[model samples]
Target: LKVTIAQIDIPCSFGPAYEGERVRGKDLFVQAGGGKTQCTEYLELADMKEIDDGKVTVIGPDIPDMKRGEVFPLGIFVQVGGREFQKDFEPILERQTHHLVNYIQGVMHAGQRDIAWVRISDAAVDKGFTLKDLGVVLHAKLHQDFSAILDKIQVTIYTKKEDVDKLTAKARAAYKYRDERVDKMTDDDVETFYSCTLCQSFAPNHVCTVSPERTGLCGAYNWMDCKAAYQINPTGPNQPIEKGECLDPKLGQWKGVNEFVSKASRGAVTHYNFYSLVQDPMTTCGCCEAIAAMLPGCNGVMTVHREYTGETPCGMKFTTLAGVMGGGASSPGFVGHSKYNITQRKFLVGDGGLLRMVWMPKSLKEEIRERLLKRGAEMGCPDLIDRIADETVGVTEEEIMPFLKEKKHPALDMEPIVG
Candidate 1:
């Protein structure tokens, strides 16, 4: 069966502010000014009756029987004639466009004079084309007068199970592709410059620079793609990542990164210094994706992810670690300087050793775990992953605590598992 799909562009205001509208008994029809408004609606003209009226019915806002949030599929099937209808709409049926005139032109080429079958759906309501646009086009074609166009159109009210299954499968395949792409991303693939325009929603002045190996503190946007996007839209939402000078190896300091961050963050961060958490300044921002808090005893640093709100030994937020590690924070041992680079020296021991504990979700932890373990083994230390209690890995908690004690360091406390 030939099926045409079109989506409506409905200006839906259904978030927090719409709660008042919902409570005030403002129906959709009422919101649309009693259907008098010329709203853009998408129409799908099809030759076959693939949609079932029982499955795809439009629920009028004024209908008392309909539930408040009831969503009904709005589609209509019309039979014009047989031979002329088949020749006219068939050619344009496969093409996707908002303009009906384009479809008519294609029909004219096929030597068809009139519309044979037309399907109507409310899916494209809020899009650029409105019901009035359709009426105007039909009236101009002399197919039907504007006054009687509404009567000629029949609404198919129910969505067929097969149609739902087809849509679901299409969506599933797209999601699978995305998942595969993410899984296939390599370290080198991820290590590139990126811009975090999304953060502007929370931090008006803040823009995160991402690289391939590193991601935004919000854990979105890998390096290479972000860099490419910035290049494509130079002054638009994303910008370039200008490299700064190398940081002092011994002191774990970078002059260029510090200067850039100080200015970018609007003096929220100044005089970038690695280590020395107490005397040196910490990262302060109007908005931060993560937060790091010192544990009460200072035995070890505890990093918290923002979404996690339970009792942490350090009471820090994930935004803290993400920001600190992203660089310019005076917290000792925190890596990720200048929002662009992810250096091993920044977080590991030698200079910046104050940052001891890093708490992240399983996904992120797994992504970096193997690399971190290799680094630990090279440094003649037990891998932090081995110390952490995880069923997937063989290392036990017992084996990990001894290493921490032997190294004169306190064991890290992990947050409880969240669903």
Candidate 2:
């Protein structure tokens, strides 16, 4: 029942759990991106004839030249080709870079797209790790992880500032194009949704149905990612689910999703509301990137990202809330989601949507600030971002009410979030 990625010849230990390990200053040998300088990673689908199989190009000095604990810009660009390859799968495969790189012992990876961060430990350097070795890990892992649709993969790592800067612009453009494609598609536009059981390895009873508006709680798989995953491995963790009938458009409950949840979760859950926070909300696996909880007294909900350790206005810290929200069980008044999902149209639609968000950690708010601004403008609340409360404002419902009233926050007047 266990699936393992093909082994690669490397100098360090590697495993799934190492993906969560942090590499801090004292132990760090070198880093790529992490705000010290520019860094971007990109993947693209190319014609089979366009790829030179097994090629790894390092444009600048290799790992040995990197000063201890120094940060530098890096650009990793991957090109793949196969008879069955589709452009939609580019981003899907691109996301694997994070986990694949992390699987190497002495290495840590974070972020995605044009803002990836990586660190190599001193022990790894002492063991003869180099830029080319990093590419070898990626090349081997990509082939092993996605052999179905990838016939060839070629990686180019850029370390010089000029080279990275030049490639980063191109990578960002590709990232923008992918984003626009997803933006135009909505949950109602697709007759078929995808199911993600990747986390089932950790949460046995968990099954996440990924729609255009609702991403998996782990935040790594979106609709397109799942779609491509299904295409590559129909029998794999990601599978296609037919939307049998729309039971409630506003609440985002469908007969097909309900049935699928019942069967996939081994009948632990039978009903789910995709858009609501307090009514049969979808159950989440433990890896969700954020938690959304209802603040009943304020007629709103407050979300806390998994990375934020601060207490939220709802009287719970993120870790405390996660204990109740995850493990494949649906809990009313609690939901888990991706930070990107916060800007979607169906985000908490059944509970007055984004306007119901009254508090978030300041850091979390800043992380999604641009998206929130645009969403606020769309909702006719041009100043909504300013109105929303963060930790700097208050961390208790009682303390938050005065600020909400002062800013005339929309959630203050919305219908009650609780029955």
Candidate 3:
């Protein structure tokens, strides 16, 4: 193994020990994304001649120039150039930003892709940390850890709103293309599913099993990403598990997957479903792109994404829901999932599928409107997207049920959501 320790030059003490620390409202000096501002992280394969190794650039105002409580848009664009590097490796390296950025003391990172969030603490600022140091840490750490596959790295950190907005649009398109790469395939097409324990660093008991239809909750690692990750490092966290016995096909359970998850989570999670959100659903970690909670009054589920700070019909804001169940626990009637998974064919299929989604934040509803409509059409409910309630419609089940009933929302007539 060709291993070279990273020569990190940040002012703050950097290591995995600080991974779980939080930068709260009182201590937060400045922040990016987390629904406060736009934050996007994109990593792409590049030509060897395109980038200078270790070159880190800040395109806008640095941390020292920012005032406390200010929310600045951010785009961390990483270009990796190496003969061994493949485009398939982009998502894996990009997802590493969550943990790698958190390694810096007084800094907390959550989410992935366009919904990524970063908070810099007053402590880190006092220690003379800058946005440049984030680039420095990621550049050094990526090279140090991925030396086998990459040879050159360049990072650009953008704080300008215009620049970040453009990157967010471009990044979202790339994400869509990457996600569709596995759209035509199904879980039964292959005898194996991959495991993603990447978030285990923060949510120690969380074990994310990536099937063809269900992507990782963080919205970064899909089945293809995990498979590629495993191919690169056989003994790494993304290992393949053969689909053994079909213990419960309705809920999408496999005997081999249960055994693997039980051992991997140290027995914290013995089994979970790939298709159902209300029954033994997969463990949720804090970085999920969105969360779904059952709303009994509406006789359906309400979902809230990290970007939507508004109150959901379930009576919890995005941050509150994440705080309560996002700690690597299996909570019935609640499950964390990727935004892309929301439109997938098997999303909550065991609980009557997309027709059961009664409410979502307006922003989230519009963001996935295209795919949502497509999935709705497949279920023979072309107007389901319009029928779904949002914050504008009402933020409480009782308030939304009237509208749902008037609009003839499908969930009202479905089977009971809670057993």
**Candidate lDDT values, in order:** 0.33, 0.82, 0.90
Which ten contiguous residues of candidate 2 have the minimum total lDDT? Answer: 1-10
Clashes found in each candidate (C-alpha, N, C closer than 3 A):
44, 1, 0
Q: Between candidates 1 and 3, name the one with more favorable lDDT.
A: 3
User: What is the C-alpha lDDT profile of model 1 across 364-413, one tens digit per residue?
Assistant: 34645655566556545555544432223212334334554554442343
How do all the candidates rank in terms of lDDT, highest first?
Answer: 3, 2, 1
Compare the candidates by TM-score and give the number of the best one: 3
Which candidate number would show the highest lDDT if scored against the true structure?
Answer: 3
Query: In model 2, what is the error at residue 328, expressed in angstroms?
Result: 5.1
Candidate 3: which stretches are off by over 4 Å?
1-6
What are the runs in model 2 whose C-alpha is more than 4 Å off?
1-7, 13-40, 46-52, 57-75, 102-131, 145-148, 158-173, 218-220, 285-289, 305-311, 315-331, 361-374, 377-380
Q: How well is each residue in 221-252 modelled by candidate 2, as lDDT tens digits?
A: 78888887877777887888897899999989
Candidate 3 lDDT over residue span 1-419, tens digit each: 33365579999999999999999899999999987788999998888899888899999999988998889999999999888888999999998898999999999998889888899999999999999998898889988888889888899999999999998888888898899998998988989999999888878999999999999988899999999999888899999999799898889999999999999999989999988888999999998989999888778888898888878888889889999888899999899999999999999888889999999888888888999989999999999999998888888888888899999999999988876
Q: Per-residue lDDT for 3 in model 1?
A: 20
Positional deviation of residue 142's Cα in model 3 after best superposition, in angstroms: 1.0
* Candidates sorted by TM-score, best first: 3, 2, 1
